[model samples]
Target: MALTSVAVVLPGRPTLFELGVVHEVFGIDRTDDGVPLIDFRLCAERPGVPVEISHGITVTPPYGLDAARGADLVVAPAYEYSDTPSEAVLEVFRQAHADGAWLLSVCSGAFALGEAGLLDGRCSTTHWRHSDELKRRFPRTRVDPGVLFVEDDRILTSAGTAAGIDACLHHVRCELGAAIATRIARRMVVPPQRDGGQRQFIDMPVPEIAGETLQPVLEWMREHLVEEQPVRVLASRAAMSERTFARRFAAETGTTPAKWLLAQRIHHARTLLEGTDLPVETVADRAGFGSAALLRHHFGARVGVAPGEYRRTFRSNERRAG
Candidate 1:
Protein backbone atom coordinates (compact mmCIF):
# COMPACT_ATOMS: atom_id res chain seq x y z
CA MET A 1 0.00 0.00 0.00
CA ALA A 2 1.20 3.49 -0.80
CA LEU A 3 -0.78 4.90 2.17
CA THR A 4 -2.72 7.19 -0.11
CA SER A 5 -5.64 7.89 2.24
CA VAL A 6 -5.88 8.72 5.95
CA ALA A 7 -9.15 9.37 7.78
CA VAL A 8 -9.18 10.88 11.24
CA VAL A 9 -12.29 10.52 13.40
CA LEU A 10 -12.58 13.79 15.23
CA PRO A 11 -14.79 13.08 18.19
CA GLY A 12 -16.36 15.88 20.21
CA ARG A 13 -13.88 17.90 22.22
CA PRO A 14 -10.88 16.31 20.57
CA THR A 15 -7.56 17.59 21.85
CA LEU A 16 -6.00 20.05 19.46
CA PHE A 17 -2.51 18.59 19.90
CA GLU A 18 -3.35 14.99 18.93
CA LEU A 19 -5.61 16.07 16.05
CA GLY A 20 -2.96 18.46 14.83
CA VAL A 21 -0.35 15.72 14.91
CA VAL A 22 -2.28 13.59 12.41
CA HIS A 23 -2.96 16.58 10.19
CA GLU A 24 0.61 17.79 10.35
CA VAL A 25 2.06 14.38 9.52
CA PHE A 26 -0.32 13.30 6.75
CA GLY A 27 -2.54 16.23 5.82
CA ILE A 28 0.08 18.86 5.13
CA ASP A 29 1.24 18.95 1.52
CA ARG A 30 4.90 17.98 1.17
CA THR A 31 4.87 16.88 -2.48
CA ASP A 32 7.62 19.35 -3.34
CA ASP A 33 9.96 17.25 -1.24
CA GLY A 34 9.00 14.14 -3.23
CA VAL A 35 6.89 12.85 -0.37
CA PRO A 36 3.71 11.03 -1.26
CA LEU A 37 0.47 12.96 -1.07
CA ILE A 38 -2.09 11.50 1.35
CA ASP A 39 -5.82 11.96 1.22
CA PHE A 40 -6.46 13.28 4.71
CA ARG A 41 -10.11 13.28 5.72
CA LEU A 42 -11.62 14.52 8.95
CA CYS A 43 -14.69 12.44 9.58
CA ALA A 44 -16.74 13.17 12.63
CA GLU A 45 -20.01 11.97 14.11
CA ARG A 46 -21.51 15.37 13.54
CA PRO A 47 -20.21 16.50 10.17
CA GLY A 48 -20.52 20.08 9.02
CA VAL A 49 -21.45 20.92 12.61
CA PRO A 50 -19.42 22.87 15.10
CA VAL A 51 -17.73 20.53 17.56
CA GLU A 52 -16.30 22.22 20.59
CA ILE A 53 -12.72 21.19 21.33
CA SER A 54 -10.05 22.43 23.67
CA HIS A 55 -11.16 25.25 25.89
CA GLY A 56 -14.17 26.67 24.04
CA ILE A 57 -12.47 26.04 20.68
CA THR A 58 -14.67 24.94 17.78
CA VAL A 59 -13.69 22.88 14.74
CA THR A 60 -16.31 22.05 12.12
CA PRO A 61 -15.15 19.24 9.89
CA PRO A 62 -16.62 18.77 6.44
CA TYR A 63 -17.07 15.01 6.26
CA GLY A 64 -19.20 12.78 8.43
CA LEU A 65 -18.14 9.33 9.55
CA ASP A 66 -20.12 7.85 6.68
CA ALA A 67 -17.96 9.65 4.16
CA ALA A 68 -14.79 7.79 5.01
CA ARG A 69 -15.32 4.95 2.59
CA GLY A 70 -11.86 3.93 1.47
CA ALA A 71 -9.44 5.14 4.08
CA ASP A 72 -6.09 3.39 4.11
CA LEU A 73 -5.56 4.51 7.67
CA VAL A 74 -8.08 5.51 10.34
CA VAL A 75 -7.07 7.56 13.36
CA ALA A 76 -8.72 8.43 16.64
CA PRO A 77 -7.34 11.19 18.79
CA ALA A 78 -7.92 11.73 22.49
CA TYR A 79 -11.66 11.71 23.15
CA GLU A 80 -13.52 12.64 26.28
CA TYR A 81 -12.83 9.65 28.51
CA SER A 82 -15.95 10.02 30.63
CA ASP A 83 -18.25 9.47 27.67
CA THR A 84 -18.38 6.11 25.96
CA PRO A 85 -17.86 6.93 22.30
CA SER A 86 -21.06 7.15 20.28
CA GLU A 87 -22.16 4.12 18.32
CA ALA A 88 -21.24 6.01 15.16
CA VAL A 89 -17.61 6.40 16.22
CA LEU A 90 -17.39 2.79 17.27
CA GLU A 91 -18.96 1.66 13.98
CA VAL A 92 -16.40 3.55 12.00
CA PHE A 93 -13.67 1.86 14.02
CA ARG A 94 -15.12 -1.61 13.49
CA GLN A 95 -15.59 -1.00 9.77
CA ALA A 96 -12.09 0.34 9.33
CA HIS A 97 -10.62 -2.65 11.12
CA ALA A 98 -12.74 -5.04 9.06
CA ASP A 99 -11.57 -3.23 5.96
CA GLY A 100 -7.99 -3.74 7.08
CA ALA A 101 -7.38 -0.04 7.40
CA TRP A 102 -4.54 0.73 9.77
CA LEU A 103 -6.05 1.83 13.10
CA LEU A 104 -4.30 4.22 15.49
CA SER A 105 -5.27 5.96 18.70
CA VAL A 106 -3.61 8.87 20.45
CA CYS A 107 -3.79 9.33 24.19
CA SER A 108 -7.17 8.47 25.63
CA GLY A 109 -8.45 7.66 22.16
CA ALA A 110 -7.61 4.05 22.95
CA PHE A 111 -10.88 3.95 24.84
CA ALA A 112 -12.86 4.17 21.63
CA LEU A 113 -10.94 1.28 20.11
CA GLY A 114 -11.59 -0.73 23.23
CA GLU A 115 -15.30 -0.01 23.04
CA ALA A 116 -15.32 -1.14 19.44
CA GLY A 117 -13.87 -4.46 20.63
CA LEU A 118 -10.80 -3.67 18.54
CA LEU A 119 -8.47 -3.85 21.48
CA ASP A 120 -9.75 -7.21 22.63
CA GLY A 121 -6.80 -9.62 22.65
CA ARG A 122 -4.59 -6.72 21.46
CA CYS A 123 -1.88 -4.80 23.26
CA SER A 124 -2.85 -1.16 23.79
CA THR A 125 -2.13 1.87 25.93
CA THR A 126 -3.26 5.33 26.89
CA HIS A 127 -1.94 8.01 29.22
CA TRP A 128 -0.14 6.58 32.23
CA ARG A 129 -2.76 8.17 34.43
CA HIS A 130 -5.44 6.24 32.57
CA SER A 131 -3.59 2.98 32.03
CA ASP A 132 -5.23 1.28 35.00
CA GLU A 133 -8.66 2.46 33.93
CA LEU A 134 -8.09 1.20 30.40
CA LYS A 135 -7.01 -2.17 31.73
CA ARG A 136 -10.09 -2.28 33.92
CA ARG A 137 -12.37 -1.39 31.03
CA PHE A 138 -10.80 -3.80 28.58
CA PRO A 139 -9.26 -6.57 30.57
CA ARG A 140 -8.42 -8.62 27.48
CA THR A 141 -6.12 -5.88 26.22
CA ARG A 142 -2.68 -5.57 27.69
CA VAL A 143 -2.16 -1.97 28.70
CA ASP A 144 1.51 -1.18 28.84
CA PRO A 145 2.22 2.13 30.51
CA GLY A 146 5.93 1.72 29.97
CA VAL A 147 6.43 1.95 26.21
CA LEU A 148 5.95 5.11 24.19
CA PHE A 149 3.80 3.23 21.67
CA VAL A 150 3.04 -0.26 20.47
CA GLU A 151 2.07 -1.91 17.16
CA ASP A 152 0.44 -5.31 17.35
CA ASP A 153 -1.11 -6.68 14.18
CA ARG A 154 -2.41 -3.38 12.70
CA ILE A 155 -3.51 -1.35 15.71
CA LEU A 156 -1.13 1.29 17.11
CA THR A 157 -1.91 2.74 20.52
CA SER A 158 0.23 5.51 21.89
CA ALA A 159 0.76 7.07 25.28
CA GLY A 160 -0.16 10.65 26.03
CA THR A 161 0.65 13.71 23.91
CA ALA A 162 4.01 13.54 22.08
CA ALA A 163 4.07 9.78 21.96
CA GLY A 164 1.44 10.03 19.23
CA ILE A 165 4.07 11.62 17.01
CA ASP A 166 6.29 8.62 17.53
CA ALA A 167 3.50 6.24 16.52
CA CYS A 168 2.53 8.21 13.40
CA LEU A 169 6.09 8.63 12.18
CA HIS A 170 6.68 4.95 12.91
CA HIS A 171 3.74 3.98 10.70
CA VAL A 172 5.04 6.29 7.98
CA ARG A 173 8.50 4.77 8.19
CA CYS A 174 7.22 1.20 8.11
CA GLU A 175 4.68 1.63 5.32
CA LEU A 176 6.24 4.37 3.21
CA GLY A 177 10.02 4.23 3.68
CA ALA A 178 12.78 5.83 5.72
CA ALA A 179 13.18 8.66 3.21
CA ILE A 180 9.56 9.76 3.35
CA ALA A 181 9.39 9.44 7.14
CA THR A 182 12.64 11.38 7.49
CA ARG A 183 11.29 14.13 5.27
CA ILE A 184 8.17 14.55 7.38
CA ALA A 185 10.13 14.37 10.62
CA ARG A 186 12.70 16.94 9.43
CA ARG A 187 9.98 19.37 8.44
CA MET A 188 8.44 18.97 11.88
CA VAL A 189 11.87 19.62 13.52
CA VAL A 190 11.58 16.51 15.74
CA PRO A 191 13.81 13.51 16.04
CA PRO A 192 13.35 10.95 13.28
CA GLN A 193 13.36 8.29 16.02
CA ARG A 194 13.46 8.48 19.81
CA ASP A 195 14.82 5.58 21.87
CA GLY A 196 13.10 6.05 25.23
CA GLY A 197 9.89 4.67 26.66
CA GLN A 198 7.08 6.47 28.54
CA ARG A 199 8.21 5.24 31.95
CA GLN A 200 10.32 8.38 32.05
CA PHE A 201 7.12 10.39 32.15
CA ILE A 202 5.36 8.49 34.95
CA ASP A 203 6.77 9.95 38.18
CA MET A 204 10.32 9.80 36.86
CA PRO A 205 12.50 12.83 37.49
CA VAL A 206 15.46 13.99 35.49
CA PRO A 207 18.68 13.57 37.46
CA GLU A 208 20.89 16.62 37.73
CA ILE A 209 24.03 16.18 35.68
CA ALA A 210 27.23 18.23 35.91
CA GLY A 211 28.41 17.57 32.35
CA GLU A 212 26.98 19.06 29.16
CA THR A 213 24.49 17.13 27.02
CA LEU A 214 25.69 14.23 24.91
CA GLN A 215 24.04 15.62 21.78
CA PRO A 216 27.31 16.21 20.00
CA VAL A 217 28.43 12.70 20.78
CA LEU A 218 25.10 11.30 19.60
CA GLU A 219 25.42 13.19 16.33
CA TRP A 220 28.90 11.80 15.90
CA MET A 221 27.59 8.33 16.65
CA ARG A 222 24.95 8.47 13.91
CA GLU A 223 27.48 9.75 11.37
CA HIS A 224 29.92 6.99 12.23
CA LEU A 225 27.40 4.14 12.31
CA VAL A 226 29.52 2.06 9.98
CA GLU A 227 32.51 2.26 12.35
CA GLU A 228 33.18 0.56 15.65
CA GLN A 229 31.63 2.34 18.69
CA PRO A 230 33.12 0.87 21.83
CA VAL A 231 31.62 2.44 24.99
CA ARG A 232 35.12 3.18 26.29
CA VAL A 233 35.84 5.21 23.15
CA LEU A 234 32.44 6.87 23.35
CA ALA A 235 32.97 7.65 27.02
CA SER A 236 36.34 9.16 26.23
CA ARG A 237 34.78 11.17 23.39
CA ALA A 238 32.21 12.55 25.82
CA ALA A 239 35.03 13.64 28.18
CA MET A 240 33.52 11.55 31.02
CA SER A 241 34.47 8.36 32.79
CA GLU A 242 32.65 5.21 31.69
CA ARG A 243 30.42 5.07 34.80
CA THR A 244 29.27 8.69 34.60
CA PHE A 245 28.84 8.45 30.84
CA ALA A 246 26.73 5.32 31.20
CA ARG A 247 24.45 6.98 33.74
CA ARG A 248 24.06 10.13 31.64
CA PHE A 249 23.44 8.14 28.50
CA ALA A 250 20.71 6.12 30.23
CA ALA A 251 19.08 9.26 31.59
CA GLU A 252 19.14 10.92 28.18
CA THR A 253 18.35 8.09 25.73
CA GLY A 254 16.73 5.51 28.08
CA THR A 255 19.00 2.89 26.56
CA THR A 256 22.65 1.93 26.58
CA PRO A 257 25.13 2.95 23.87
CA ALA A 258 25.35 -0.56 22.44
CA LYS A 259 21.55 -0.97 22.10
CA TRP A 260 21.22 2.49 20.62
CA LEU A 261 23.95 1.76 18.13
CA LEU A 262 22.28 -1.50 17.17
CA ALA A 263 19.00 0.31 16.55
CA GLN A 264 20.80 2.95 14.49
CA ARG A 265 22.53 0.27 12.51
CA ILE A 266 19.23 -1.44 11.80
CA HIS A 267 17.66 1.85 10.81
CA HIS A 268 20.56 2.63 8.51
CA ALA A 269 20.37 -0.84 7.08
CA ARG A 270 16.66 -0.36 6.38
CA THR A 271 17.42 2.90 4.60
CA LEU A 272 20.03 1.19 2.47
CA LEU A 273 17.74 -1.71 1.67
CA GLU A 274 14.93 0.55 0.54
CA GLY A 275 16.85 3.11 -1.49
CA THR A 276 19.63 1.12 -3.14
CA ASP A 277 20.12 -2.19 -4.89
CA LEU A 278 23.17 -3.00 -2.80
CA PRO A 279 23.67 -6.64 -1.84
CA VAL A 280 22.63 -7.57 1.68
CA GLU A 281 26.22 -8.28 2.62
CA THR A 282 27.29 -4.86 1.37
CA VAL A 283 24.42 -3.22 3.25
CA ALA A 284 25.32 -5.14 6.40
CA ASP A 285 28.92 -4.01 6.16
CA ARG A 286 27.87 -0.45 5.41
CA ALA A 287 25.50 -0.44 8.38
CA GLY A 288 28.23 -1.76 10.72
CA PHE A 289 26.77 -5.25 11.05
CA GLY A 290 29.89 -6.61 9.23
CA SER A 291 28.16 -9.61 7.62
CA ALA A 292 24.87 -10.63 6.03
CA ALA A 293 24.17 -13.36 8.56
CA LEU A 294 24.60 -10.98 11.47
CA LEU A 295 22.36 -8.42 9.79
CA ARG A 296 19.69 -11.05 9.13
CA HIS A 297 19.67 -12.24 12.71
CA HIS A 298 19.34 -8.82 14.33
CA PHE A 299 17.15 -7.28 11.65
CA GLY A 300 14.71 -10.19 11.73
CA ALA A 301 14.63 -10.14 15.50
CA ARG A 302 13.87 -6.41 15.60
CA VAL A 303 11.86 -5.92 12.38
CA GLY A 304 10.11 -9.30 12.21
CA VAL A 305 11.11 -9.75 8.56
CA ALA A 306 14.14 -10.54 6.48
CA PRO A 307 15.94 -7.61 4.86
CA GLY A 308 15.14 -8.85 1.36
CA GLU A 309 11.48 -9.14 2.19
CA TYR A 310 11.30 -5.68 3.69
CA ARG A 311 13.08 -4.23 0.67
CA ARG A 312 10.74 -5.94 -1.75
CA THR A 313 7.71 -4.65 0.15
CA PHE A 314 8.81 -1.04 0.60
CA ARG A 315 11.46 -0.26 -1.98
CA SER A 316 11.92 3.49 -2.28
CA ASN A 317 10.89 3.52 -5.92
CA GLU A 318 7.48 2.06 -5.12
CA ARG A 319 5.03 1.38 -2.29
CA ARG A 320 3.78 -1.79 -0.71
CA ALA A 321 0.94 -3.34 -2.69
CA GLY A 322 -1.78 -3.73 -0.15
Candidate 2:
Protein backbone atom coordinates (compact mmCIF):
# COMPACT_ATOMS: atom_id res chain seq x y z
CA MET A 1 0.00 0.00 0.00
CA ALA A 2 1.14 3.54 -0.73
CA LEU A 3 1.57 6.14 1.97
CA THR A 4 -1.82 7.61 2.84
CA SER A 5 -2.55 11.02 4.33
CA VAL A 6 -4.45 11.03 7.62
CA ALA A 7 -6.13 14.06 9.10
CA VAL A 8 -6.70 14.05 12.83
CA VAL A 9 -9.37 16.38 14.21
CA LEU A 10 -9.11 17.72 17.71
CA PRO A 11 -11.85 19.20 19.83
CA GLY A 12 -11.02 21.65 22.59
CA ARG A 13 -9.77 19.98 25.76
CA PRO A 14 -9.09 16.72 23.95
CA THR A 15 -7.86 13.72 25.90
CA LEU A 16 -4.08 13.90 25.57
CA PHE A 17 -3.54 10.14 25.69
CA GLU A 18 -5.92 9.37 22.85
CA LEU A 19 -4.40 12.14 20.71
CA GLY A 20 -0.94 10.74 21.38
CA VAL A 21 -2.14 7.31 20.28
CA VAL A 22 -3.13 8.70 16.89
CA HIS A 23 0.08 10.69 16.55
CA GLU A 24 2.26 7.73 17.46
CA VAL A 25 0.46 5.42 15.09
CA PHE A 26 0.10 7.76 12.11
CA GLY A 27 2.01 11.02 12.58
CA ILE A 28 5.54 9.75 13.16
CA ASP A 29 7.75 8.90 10.20
CA ARG A 30 8.45 5.16 10.14
CA THR A 31 9.31 4.61 6.50
CA ASP A 32 13.06 4.18 7.06
CA ASP A 33 12.49 0.57 8.10
CA GLY A 34 10.22 -0.38 5.16
CA VAL A 35 6.98 0.27 7.01
CA PRO A 36 4.11 1.84 5.14
CA LEU A 37 4.16 5.42 6.36
CA ILE A 38 1.08 7.58 6.80
CA ASP A 39 1.31 11.31 6.20
CA PHE A 40 -0.44 12.73 9.20
CA ARG A 41 -1.55 16.23 10.23
CA LEU A 42 -3.54 17.57 13.14
CA CYS A 43 -6.45 19.78 12.19
CA ALA A 44 -8.76 22.05 14.08
CA GLU A 45 -11.66 24.24 13.00
CA ARG A 46 -9.21 27.15 12.80
CA PRO A 47 -5.50 27.43 12.23
CA GLY A 48 -2.98 29.27 14.47
CA VAL A 49 -5.14 28.83 17.56
CA PRO A 50 -3.82 26.90 20.52
CA VAL A 51 -6.39 24.43 21.80
CA GLU A 52 -6.31 23.51 25.49
CA ILE A 53 -5.72 19.89 26.38
CA SER A 54 -6.71 17.92 29.43
CA HIS A 55 -3.34 18.25 31.20
CA GLY A 56 -2.88 21.99 30.60
CA ILE A 57 -1.01 21.75 27.30
CA THR A 58 -2.05 23.96 24.41
CA VAL A 59 -1.77 22.31 20.99
CA THR A 60 -1.75 24.55 17.99
CA PRO A 61 -2.75 22.65 14.89
CA PRO A 62 -1.05 23.71 11.66
CA TYR A 63 -4.18 23.16 9.58
CA GLY A 64 -7.93 23.58 9.91
CA LEU A 65 -10.89 21.32 9.14
CA ASP A 66 -10.37 22.03 5.44
CA ALA A 67 -7.23 19.92 5.61
CA ALA A 68 -9.43 16.83 6.10
CA ARG A 69 -11.33 17.42 2.87
CA GLY A 70 -9.00 15.30 0.76
CA ALA A 71 -7.25 13.10 3.27
CA ASP A 72 -7.53 9.35 2.87
CA LEU A 73 -8.48 8.93 6.50
CA VAL A 74 -9.87 11.27 9.20
CA VAL A 75 -9.44 10.47 12.86
CA ALA A 76 -11.27 12.21 15.68
CA PRO A 77 -9.46 11.72 18.98
CA ALA A 78 -11.26 12.13 22.29
CA TYR A 79 -12.89 15.41 23.27
CA GLU A 80 -13.56 16.58 26.78
CA TYR A 81 -16.62 15.31 28.63
CA SER A 82 -18.67 18.46 28.25
CA ASP A 83 -17.68 19.52 24.76
CA THR A 84 -20.63 19.40 22.38
CA PRO A 85 -19.32 19.28 18.81
CA SER A 86 -20.12 22.29 16.64
CA GLU A 87 -22.14 22.05 13.43
CA ALA A 88 -19.24 23.39 11.36
CA VAL A 89 -16.96 20.67 12.64
CA LEU A 90 -19.70 18.15 11.96
CA GLU A 91 -19.86 19.40 8.37
CA VAL A 92 -16.19 18.63 7.98
CA PHE A 93 -16.93 15.04 8.97
CA ARG A 94 -19.97 14.88 6.74
CA GLN A 95 -18.09 16.26 3.77
CA ALA A 96 -15.25 13.86 4.29
CA HIS A 97 -17.68 10.94 4.47
CA ALA A 98 -19.35 12.14 1.29
CA ASP A 99 -15.94 12.11 -0.38
CA GLY A 100 -15.52 8.44 0.69
CA ALA A 101 -12.77 9.06 3.21
CA TRP A 102 -12.64 6.63 6.11
CA LEU A 103 -13.76 8.22 9.39
CA LEU A 104 -12.62 6.93 12.79
CA SER A 105 -13.52 8.02 16.32
CA VAL A 106 -11.74 7.36 19.59
CA CYS A 107 -13.22 7.47 23.09
CA SER A 108 -15.34 10.59 23.56
CA GLY A 109 -14.56 11.34 19.94
CA ALA A 110 -17.47 8.98 19.30
CA PHE A 111 -19.65 11.55 21.03
CA ALA A 112 -18.47 14.21 18.60
CA LEU A 113 -19.19 11.90 15.66
CA GLY A 114 -22.65 11.29 17.07
CA GLU A 115 -23.28 15.02 17.46
CA ALA A 116 -22.07 15.53 13.89
CA GLY A 117 -24.82 13.07 12.87
CA LEU A 118 -22.28 10.89 11.09
CA LEU A 119 -23.02 7.90 13.29
CA ASP A 120 -26.75 7.80 12.70
CA GLY A 121 -28.03 4.30 11.95
CA ARG A 122 -24.48 3.04 12.46
CA CYS A 123 -23.07 0.58 14.93
CA SER A 124 -20.65 2.66 17.00
CA THR A 125 -19.13 2.69 20.46
CA THR A 126 -17.45 4.97 23.02
CA HIS A 127 -16.07 4.91 26.52
CA TRP A 128 -18.31 2.84 28.72
CA ARG A 129 -18.95 5.87 30.91
CA HIS A 130 -20.30 7.93 28.03
CA SER A 131 -21.95 5.19 25.97
CA ASP A 132 -25.34 5.75 27.61
CA GLU A 133 -25.23 9.49 27.08
CA LEU A 134 -24.18 8.95 23.46
CA LYS A 135 -27.10 6.57 22.86
CA ARG A 136 -29.53 8.92 24.60
CA ARG A 137 -28.22 11.88 22.63
CA PHE A 138 -28.24 10.08 19.28
CA PRO A 139 -30.96 7.50 19.25
CA ARG A 140 -30.26 6.60 15.64
CA THR A 141 -26.85 5.12 16.43
CA ARG A 142 -26.80 1.59 17.76
CA VAL A 143 -24.32 2.12 20.58
CA ASP A 144 -22.67 -1.12 21.62
CA PRO A 145 -20.67 -0.21 24.68
CA GLY A 146 -19.44 -3.78 24.95
CA VAL A 147 -17.21 -3.82 21.87
CA LEU A 148 -13.70 -2.41 21.60
CA PHE A 149 -14.55 -1.12 18.14
CA VAL A 150 -17.36 -1.24 15.61
CA GLU A 151 -16.48 -1.19 11.90
CA ASP A 152 -19.53 0.07 10.03
CA ASP A 153 -18.41 0.33 6.42
CA ARG A 154 -16.21 3.46 6.20
CA ILE A 155 -16.82 4.60 9.77
CA LEU A 156 -14.90 3.00 12.65
CA THR A 157 -15.47 3.79 16.31
CA SER A 158 -13.32 2.60 19.20
CA ALA A 159 -13.90 2.50 22.91
CA GLY A 160 -11.87 4.71 25.31
CA THR A 161 -8.13 5.57 25.22
CA ALA A 162 -6.15 2.38 24.67
CA ALA A 163 -8.80 0.84 22.53
CA GLY A 164 -7.94 3.56 20.01
CA ILE A 165 -4.58 1.88 19.50
CA ASP A 166 -6.27 -1.46 18.96
CA ALA A 167 -8.65 0.09 16.45
CA CYS A 168 -5.84 1.83 14.56
CA LEU A 169 -3.64 -1.24 14.44
CA HIS A 170 -6.61 -3.31 13.42
CA HIS A 171 -7.09 -0.96 10.47
CA VAL A 172 -3.46 -1.28 9.54
CA ARG A 173 -3.78 -5.04 9.68
CA CYS A 174 -6.87 -4.87 7.54
CA GLU A 175 -5.23 -2.71 4.89
CA LEU A 176 -1.68 -3.92 5.16
CA GLY A 177 -0.85 -7.43 6.34
CA ALA A 178 -0.96 -8.63 9.95
CA ALA A 179 2.84 -8.79 9.73
CA ILE A 180 3.05 -5.05 9.21
CA ALA A 181 0.58 -4.31 11.96
CA THR A 182 2.30 -6.68 14.38
CA ARG A 183 5.68 -5.19 13.50
CA ILE A 184 4.36 -1.75 14.37
CA ALA A 185 2.92 -3.08 17.62
CA ARG A 186 6.29 -4.61 18.51
CA ARG A 187 8.04 -1.30 17.85
CA MET A 188 5.48 0.51 20.01
CA VAL A 189 5.93 -2.05 22.84
CA VAL A 190 2.22 -2.80 23.05
CA PRO A 191 0.40 -6.08 22.76
CA PRO A 192 -0.31 -6.94 19.15
CA GLN A 193 -3.88 -7.68 20.13
CA ARG A 194 -5.92 -8.14 23.25
CA ASP A 195 -7.92 -11.30 23.70
CA GLY A 196 -11.69 -10.86 23.85
CA GLY A 197 -13.52 -7.73 22.77
CA GLN A 198 -14.68 -4.81 24.93
CA ARG A 199 -17.51 -7.01 26.19
CA GLN A 200 -15.21 -7.66 29.15
CA PHE A 201 -15.98 -4.12 30.29
CA ILE A 202 -19.66 -4.87 30.72
CA ASP A 203 -19.24 -5.86 34.36
CA MET A 204 -16.95 -3.02 35.38
CA PRO A 205 -19.18 -1.30 37.95
CA VAL A 206 -22.36 -2.63 39.45
CA PRO A 207 -25.18 -0.15 39.33
CA GLU A 208 -26.75 1.26 42.47
CA ILE A 209 -29.94 -0.13 44.14
CA ALA A 210 -32.59 -0.86 41.50
CA GLY A 211 -30.05 -1.65 38.80
CA GLU A 212 -27.60 -3.25 41.23
CA THR A 213 -29.77 -6.25 41.87
CA LEU A 214 -29.17 -7.79 38.43
CA GLN A 215 -25.38 -7.86 38.59
CA PRO A 216 -25.19 -11.33 40.06
CA VAL A 217 -27.53 -12.74 37.45
CA LEU A 218 -25.60 -11.06 34.64
CA GLU A 219 -22.35 -12.48 35.91
CA TRP A 220 -23.91 -15.93 36.17
CA MET A 221 -25.10 -15.81 32.58
CA ARG A 222 -21.63 -14.86 31.39
CA GLU A 223 -20.07 -17.73 33.30
CA HIS A 224 -22.57 -20.30 32.10
CA LEU A 225 -23.16 -19.13 28.54
CA VAL A 226 -22.43 -22.60 27.12
CA GLU A 227 -25.29 -24.16 29.05
CA GLU A 228 -28.57 -24.69 27.25
CA GLN A 229 -30.53 -22.53 29.66
CA PRO A 230 -33.66 -20.68 28.58
CA VAL A 231 -34.67 -17.17 29.65
CA ARG A 232 -37.31 -18.48 32.05
CA VAL A 233 -34.69 -20.69 33.64
CA LEU A 234 -32.32 -17.75 33.91
CA ALA A 235 -35.08 -15.61 35.40
CA SER A 236 -35.88 -18.34 37.88
CA ARG A 237 -32.22 -18.59 38.88
CA ALA A 238 -32.18 -14.81 39.44
CA ALA A 239 -35.15 -15.26 41.79
CA MET A 240 -37.20 -12.66 39.94
CA SER A 241 -40.40 -12.98 37.99
CA GLU A 242 -39.72 -13.28 34.23
CA ARG A 243 -41.45 -9.95 33.48
CA THR A 244 -39.53 -8.13 36.21
CA PHE A 245 -36.29 -9.74 35.15
CA ALA A 246 -36.79 -8.75 31.54
CA ARG A 247 -37.53 -5.10 32.37
CA ARG A 248 -34.74 -4.76 34.95
CA PHE A 249 -32.21 -6.56 32.77
CA ALA A 250 -32.72 -4.06 29.95
CA ALA A 251 -32.50 -1.13 32.35
CA GLU A 252 -29.23 -2.30 33.88
CA THR A 253 -27.47 -3.98 30.95
CA GLY A 254 -28.55 -1.53 28.23
CA THR A 255 -29.80 -4.57 26.21
CA THR A 256 -32.17 -7.45 26.62
CA PRO A 257 -30.78 -10.49 28.41
CA ALA A 258 -31.18 -12.65 25.32
CA LYS A 259 -29.32 -10.21 23.11
CA TRP A 260 -26.55 -9.87 25.64
CA LEU A 261 -26.19 -13.62 25.92
CA LEU A 262 -26.14 -14.02 22.16
CA ALA A 263 -23.49 -11.32 21.89
CA GLN A 264 -21.35 -13.09 24.43
CA ARG A 265 -21.82 -16.38 22.68
CA ILE A 266 -20.88 -14.85 19.35
CA HIS A 267 -17.86 -13.20 20.91
CA HIS A 268 -16.73 -16.51 22.29
CA ALA A 269 -17.27 -18.10 18.90
CA ARG A 270 -15.10 -15.44 17.27
CA THR A 271 -12.35 -16.09 19.79
CA LEU A 272 -12.42 -19.76 18.96
CA LEU A 273 -12.57 -18.99 15.29
CA GLU A 274 -9.51 -16.78 15.45
CA GLY A 275 -7.40 -18.65 17.97
CA THR A 276 -8.20 -22.30 17.53
CA ASP A 277 -8.26 -24.97 14.84
CA LEU A 278 -11.74 -26.07 15.80
CA PRO A 279 -14.26 -26.79 13.07
CA VAL A 280 -17.24 -24.48 12.65
CA GLU A 281 -19.59 -27.10 14.06
CA THR A 282 -17.47 -27.62 17.17
CA VAL A 283 -16.95 -23.91 17.57
CA ALA A 284 -20.67 -23.31 17.37
CA ASP A 285 -21.40 -26.08 19.82
CA ARG A 286 -18.84 -24.84 22.31
CA ALA A 287 -20.17 -21.31 22.08
CA GLY A 288 -23.70 -22.60 22.78
CA PHE A 289 -25.06 -21.84 19.32
CA GLY A 290 -25.88 -25.56 18.73
CA SER A 291 -25.20 -25.62 14.96
CA ALA A 292 -22.79 -24.28 12.37
CA ALA A 293 -25.70 -22.69 10.48
CA LEU A 294 -26.70 -20.77 13.59
CA LEU A 295 -23.10 -19.66 14.07
CA ARG A 296 -22.94 -18.47 10.48
CA HIS A 297 -26.17 -16.51 10.85
CA HIS A 298 -25.23 -14.67 14.06
CA PHE A 299 -21.51 -14.41 13.40
CA GLY A 300 -22.15 -12.89 10.00
CA ALA A 301 -24.60 -10.45 11.54
CA ARG A 302 -22.23 -9.46 14.36
CA VAL A 303 -18.69 -9.90 13.02
CA GLY A 304 -19.68 -9.35 9.39
CA VAL A 305 -17.83 -12.52 8.33
CA ALA A 306 -18.58 -16.20 8.31
CA PRO A 307 -16.75 -18.37 10.85
CA GLY A 308 -14.95 -20.27 8.10
CA GLU A 309 -13.79 -17.07 6.50
CA TYR A 310 -12.60 -15.76 9.83
CA ARG A 311 -10.71 -18.98 10.53
CA ARG A 312 -9.10 -18.96 7.10
CA THR A 313 -7.96 -15.37 7.61
CA PHE A 314 -6.47 -16.21 10.98
CA ARG A 315 -4.80 -19.29 9.59
CA SER A 316 -3.29 -17.17 6.84
CA ASN A 317 -2.05 -14.79 9.49
CA GLU A 318 -0.47 -17.64 11.41
CA ARG A 319 1.23 -18.87 8.25
CA ARG A 320 2.60 -15.37 7.63
CA ALA A 321 3.91 -15.20 11.19
CA GLY A 322 5.54 -18.58 10.93
> What Cα-based lDDT does every candidate model obtain?
0.86, 0.77
The TM-scores, one per candidate, come to 0.94, 0.65
Per residue, candidate 2 scores C-alpha lDDT tens digits across 1-322 of 1227899987556878899998888787767645666778899888889898856788889998888878878888998758676777888888888888888888889877887888888899888888899989999999888877888969989998888998988776555545566678888998555422535255545433343476687678768877876779878987777887776676555566777788778757766776678888999899998999988999888667788887787666545433
True lDDT of residue 276, candidate 1 = 92
Worst 10 residues of 2 by lDDT: 203-212
Sequence-dependent TM-score of model 1 = 0.94
Candidate 1: regions farther than 4 A off: 195-200, 316-322
Evaluated at residue 237, the lDDT of candidate 2 is 81
Could you give candidate 1's per-residue lDDT for residues 1-322 as a string of tens digits? Answer: 4588999987557888888898999999999988888889998877889888867888888998977767988998887878788888889989988988899999999998999999999888888899999999999998898877888878999998988898899889888888888999999999887642424367666667787899999999999988899989999999998998887887787678988889899989998998899999999999999999999999999888999999988864364422
